[model samples]
Target: MMLTSAAQAIGLFIATNIDDIIVLSLFFARGAGRPGTTSRILAGQYLGFAGILAAAVLVSLGAGAFLPEAAIPYFGLIPLVLGLWAAWQAWRDDDDDDDDAKVAGKAVAVWTVAAVTFANGGDNIGVYVPVFLNVGPAATAAYCVVFLVLVAALVVAARFVATRPGIDEVLERWEHILFPVVLIGLGLVILYSGGAFGL
Candidate 1:
């Protein structure tokens, strides 16, 4: 049972965080050539992930006790709305200049990254709640620890990838379009998995 729980946790963590690599890579690329920026991005990622985990635990506990299983999935709507908003912003900023992009890049802060991470992870809660409910406290603790380690490793890998010479050019060229498209796709997947569209 312990092994099974651990495996499940690892799988869940990977599944939920795969997209984080892309997001983190973008952040790392933006922070490149700036001293102390990578550290700030890493810190923000950790902070954001912590928020997501905490929310999952709280919602899992609360919803397990009070909310119906069917209704719990509707939380996916949070990400859906956020994604739509992001897409709209991206569209509206289609004519943005390099100067604006530079300004936006300069404005990247730890808290800002944390907020983006947390908002981007809205779909995680929909998947985590049920998983958390099925596991024991000990297993949950193990899962959290493993998730933390994996998230750190992910940040490192993303940073490395982002710093690669050719990678930055590709990311920079399409990031505006790619980011919003990814968000929108993620939202739709969450809505479908959560059965939100059924109603």
Candidate 2:
């Protein structure tokens, strides 16, 4: 049971994430491909995710609460829309540099990224609910630890690829493909949980 729950946690986490490469590329583009800035952004992203994990733990422990059971279906609806929107953004993107321009013109600070990342992850809290409630505390802790390590590794890899001279262009050209795949998977999960397939 623990093994299956941990695997489910890891799989769901990976399947639902699109911000990984998006944020990594944004930092690299803005930081002039510097490793330090990429790392800082990566750190910030992980910190944001950590905050979500802590919140989930509290929710699971009942120190905090989730939306009412009656509201869960609607909460589930949000990620479906968000996923489709992200996919559309990926498909319509003209220039990767536009993100940098938006960031600079808007003067979006680092803390803003942290806050947005955290908020963006809110829909993902659903992924932890079943595992936390069913798998027991040890399994939950293991799931969280494994998720943290995987996210760290992914961030490091994204930073490395973003810093590479030619890879940035390749990633930029192909992100439309990758982003939609992730988004679609997230959407499907939400739909399934909402009883679209009677699961």
- Clashes (candidate 1): 0
Which pairs clash in the backbone of model 1?
none
Clashes counted in candidate 2 amount to: 0
Q: State the lDDT of candidate 2 residue by residue for 28-106, as single tens digits.
A: 5445533356556666777878876887777787855454333333433444564476567655654564665433221
Q: Point out the worst 10-residue segment of candidate 2 by lDDT.
A: 101-110
Across 94-187, the per-residue lDDT of candidate 1 in tens digits comes to 6775654643443347875676677667677667777777875677788888888888888888888886889987776666666556656655
TM-scores vs. true structure, each candidate: 0.69, 0.58
Report the C-alpha displacement of residue 167, candidate 1, in angstroms.
1.2
Which candidate's TM-score is highest? 1
